[model samples]
Target: MELPGGLGGNDAPDGESLPELLRSWRNRAYPREVSETAAPRRRRSGLTQRELARLAGVSERWYGNLERGEPAEYSEGFLDRLSSALGLGEAERSALYLRAIGRPPTSAVAPGSAAAAGMDLTLQQFLDNQAPNPAFVTDLAWNVIGWNDPLREWFPWAAQQGNQMLWALLAPQARKQLVDWEGSWARPYLGQIRYARAQHPDDEALASLEREILARSAEARKMWNLREVHEHADGDLRRLRLPCHRGREVSVRIVALRLMRSDRLRVNVLMESGRAVGA
Candidate 1:
């Protein structure tokens, strides 16, 4: 008997059934070689549904429902995981998302303008000019792509670490440098990451970084699962103990500027608040 939405039947729609399309793509993409002497089995040599489900980090039943074309809301996060598991390229990924959601994947990132071109030179000058105030730039994933000399001098760890999220959430030195690490820095940073994840569900790099943090740090994992979100505001206060000044604690005004030309790049500057010492 034919199943719903043309399962195991020729009476399927003119367009390829989503299940069949996924199966065919999976079979072709992950072909397994059999011994030459032995006759190949009737079934295609590819990952089993269970294996695919495992790779996608979904329950086997949910994956089965998806293949069966069951009527259910497929979230972007689920689609992203499935896409990553199947190793879908941009085109295939977009198609899968469209088919599943009846719309294309949305990116929070905006198109970069001419001024955003030559990112290295532009970012270098941007940082260099913010002298005295520690300044740095990060990609959407919070990777420290560029920084100024003051930033390097103020926070040596920032120069050493590639990812700001990882540095704040996982670095041992961060706990020492930031006062109230969990309350002030780690939790808020994790919340920002959660917000970013929601904003850019299709960003595989962000997903991978989150996974790495979850795997490596128990604190980050706990904070991540909380599902909190935060948007950093300009002129916020951040307290840090600068090692260069012999453990002198300073409060700085945070200035976060999003580059209009590029949605992915942002400049973070910390200006020292001219307050009396220990006042």
Candidate 2:
């Protein structure tokens, strides 16, 4: 189905088109201090666009157009070809597709004031009550809105300076602190962000966050290319591996409850299960 902004019968007049809207969004996608790369490297690691085209089994010009964001027809097959050439995983492939379609990256989210206002106090109390279990609330962009003390104690990386979910994944401490850090937690959380991107294409904050993180972290860059989306809901569990505790693994269940008062926030409660206790 076509989204709210698509090149369908409801699009703006010929003079004002999707490209114009997309360019505007792209401009806003970058943070004030950051800028889009002037020239995206087509041939790096001794692999040229032509070589990549041959690998993907597509024409070089076509591949170039896709990267340049020029008007061109995109197919699932073409996307697969590009994904292979770029060595993109599920998250990275998804990110490429979103950018191609003029949508922001999954990791994109608002910071500071752009984040939705204060959450309900009752909700905060509810999150705090989840003790022993590691529960933290995040905005659309995955910022740490609320987290209990146990989480901080177990995963010191969780209580780092930035405390942003994405930052925790990129921070050096996280690798030493959490086990299976990439596959179990990071991937699924990225999937959630991708889902949000699909739902809110025009969300500047979300898109901006995605771009910034992609530029900063290689893990994030690789993950962004995969393009996976997972919904925030109940009964989701992730096992975290930590070093300080002999690389002990903790299993935590993620339960998400949406608030009607603020369509912008999702109150997530993470609870510990049998194996996760004392970790």
lDDT for each residue of candidate 2 in 157-270, tens digit (9 for 90 to 100)? 333212245445555555544457778667776777788888888975566556555655788778868987777647876666654346566666767777777766666655
**How well does each candidate superpose onto the true structure, as a TM-score?**
0.56, 0.51
Model 1 clash pairs are: none
For model 2 the local lDDT of residue 224 reads 68
**Backbone clash count for every predicted candidate, in the order shown:** 0, 20
How well is each residue in 1-279 modelled by candidate 1, as lDDT tens digits? 333333323332346657876786567556332121235567655767765664444457878888887756665545654665576665566566555665656642211111222257866887888787888887776656578888888765455324577667765667888888988888888888888888999876578667767876887878777887897646778899866768688888888998877778878888888732113
Tell me the spans in candidate 1 whose CA falls farther than 4 Å from its real position: 1-118, 275-279
Off by over 4 Å in 2: 1-116, 155-163, 243-247, 275-279
User: Against the true structure, whose lDDT is highest?
Assistant: 1
Candidate 2's TM-score reads 0.51
Error of 2 at 122 (Å): 1.8
Whole-model Cα lDDT per candidate? Answer: 0.66, 0.52
Model 1, backbone clash pairs (residues 3+ apart or across chains), number: 0
